[model samples]
Target: MTQWLVLAAAIAVEVFATLGLRASEGFRKKAWIAPVVLGYLASFYGLWLTLRLGMPVGIAYGVWTACGVALVAVIARYVFRDPLTWKMIIGIGLIVAGVLTIELAGVVH
Candidate 1:
């Protein structure tokens, strides 16, 4: 249970870090860099803990990437004023479906 929580936290942190990167504008600004760095550090550490809990690396990674991308897209549209076109929603839906398939498949290979 804690492992799953950690993975969730890691994904959220990673999303924030990615958003911070966009705001950082190539790390020229100080405000954005700090959160980006800390967020990534915390995310990586959380992932490490998840692995220690016997989570398969590939499965954990696939979940992380898919969820992160989807969440980021949604947040971008709402928080960053990005357009939420049908195409974007469809893309995100596909990503979610793919991730669900992978989770259901259960084997990495």
Candidate 2:
């Protein structure tokens, strides 16, 4: 339970850092730099905690990255007016499915 929460926090922070990277405007904006740096630092720390809690590296990373990609895509569509094509949506769906498959495999092992 705690590990899951930590993983979720890590993913959320990574998403925030990714958005902050866009807002940084090629690292020209000073204000956005802080969030970008801090968010990544915190995110990695959370991931470490998740790993220490016994989640396998493959399962943890698969879910972490997949969720982050799907979430950032949706958030970018709204926040940045970025296009979310059907193909991208399908790809995201597949990523989610792959993560679930990994998780199920972990459970059975």
- Specify the highest-TM-score model's number: 2
Model 1, residue 24: C-alpha shift (Å) = 1.6
Candidate 2 error regions (>4 Å): none
Worst 10 residues of 2 by lDDT: 18-27
Error of 1 at 71 (Å): 0.8
Model 1 / residue 35 / CA error / Å: 1.1
TM-score of 2: 0.97
Residue 48, candidate 1: alpha-carbon lDDT: 90
Candidate 2 local lDDT, 1-109, one digit each (tens): 9899999999999999999998788899999998999999999998999999999999989999998999999999999988999999999999999889988988998
lDDT of 1 by residue, 2-109 (tens): 888999999999999998887787998889988999999999998898999988786688889888988888888877887888998899889888877877787545
TM, every model: 0.88, 0.97
